[model samples]
Target: MTTQQLEVNFSELINKPKATLAGLAGAKRILLRRRDAEDLVITTAARVEQDAQVMSAGTRMFVALVRHDTAARSLLLEIIPEAFPWVRFLSEESVRAFAAELAEVLPAAESLGNMSAVATTIAAWQHTAEVHSDPELLAALTTDRGEDYGPVPEPGVTG
Candidate 1:
């Protein structure tokens, strides 16, 4: 049986702190809904630590599996194309390289709790596959232009 998550409006939380907190008695966490802002989650410190520990252990196990088991690595490669159809855009060698780099980055990112880095890594590889899939773009990129290029503008800056 699935237990419903306790939900309390943000205004109710501020107006009736005791009652809002009391909802945690029957739930592991309470989702604080906000009409005008991002929603918030209220959970105990113990729950947070427990989740971190589980994630750490799971990361370690996955890293070990990929590193030591060829079958596991092969399975990952086999499923990767199915999981992300964009991977098919990449050559076999690029796909293998992407998998290796992902395996290396994923454990480190999880260890540091930096999921964004993992997302960026995947996006970077996907974009590379996209470029490789386009013959004209790939040719343009691979062709060296001897002309001097102007300096790149800083990110998020506009003229």
Candidate 2:
């Protein structure tokens, strides 16, 4: 399917909703750019559902191929570094582990119509590889400090 998206300032969406929506007549989606916050995508619920279905089908096809074909799995592992040069910072074992985890997460994320799981998995692995790439950071993180620190508070929560 062809994707047509138009970009407009977020203010245009808020101040001139009608004109902003008119842009959608020529494009399937509107990308609202926000200077101080994350950008947003505006599209019909039907378009969103169609995208989810396409993603689910494609993810399932890939999962099936990898499960049934050893060659496909090997090819995926072999191409990891090619696709993401940062993976080169990771050891072979870590790279394989990253691939395995990503493969496991992709289908589940797609089925849920949410890519957060897949994104989180990739970010975690990427952070691991980044740490591995730095000798000082890796040593500091891996070493035992032998000190009893206070209990850590939950992230994003304040006392």
Candidate 3:
């Protein structure tokens, strides 16, 4: 499978009352806006799958590093309960710091500064994680189901 990266503006995608989304007419898309509606749209399902693998691999490495590395994770989690109010914030900050450290050795984090506001950025991250981490949450968010999830059972729970 092959994938192509397309640079597009949100204004262009949402130009009409129709969906610019994937279907018999188009390919899958990931909308990312960094500035002034500047967006990167991944317009192929195959590409999406490939990108997902790349992202997942990167995420796993990051988790492994922070989860296993003592000193690095400690500095960020010092206040534990204070500095990090949300998991997303912690992840973003960890990535930020890691990128900064990476920059010392190699130029990086060049675009991190252009990221959206902390609150909104963290919110989106948390929202996506929530949807992926829990099907019920995704269902509830996507479609209103009057049922409460009962604290969302722990992942992989066994009776």
Provide backbone clash counts, one per model: 0, 0, 0
lDDT per residue as tens, model 3, 1-159? 423333445664567315445421443454545466455654557765686566556655655566578775765455443533444433556545533343232212212322134345446645655565676766677896577756766789964
Per-residue lDDT of 1-159 in model 1, one digit per residue for the tens? 324578888999999999999888788899999999999999889988998889779878988999999999999899999877999989889889988988888888887877778799899998998998899999999988887777878999985
- Order the numbered candidates by lDDT, best leading: 2, 1, 3
Error of 1 at 115 (Å): 3.2
Best by lDDT: 2
lDDT of each: 0.88, 0.90, 0.50
Better of 1 and 3 by TM-score: 1
- What TM-score fits each model? 0.72, 0.85, 0.29
**Ranked candidates, highest TM-score first:** 2, 1, 3
Task: Decide which is better by lDDT, 1 or 3.
Answer: 1
Per-residue lDDT value at 5 in model 2:
92
List residue ranges in candidate 1 displaced over 4 A.
Answer: 1-4, 126-159
Backbone steric clashes in candidate 1, count? 0
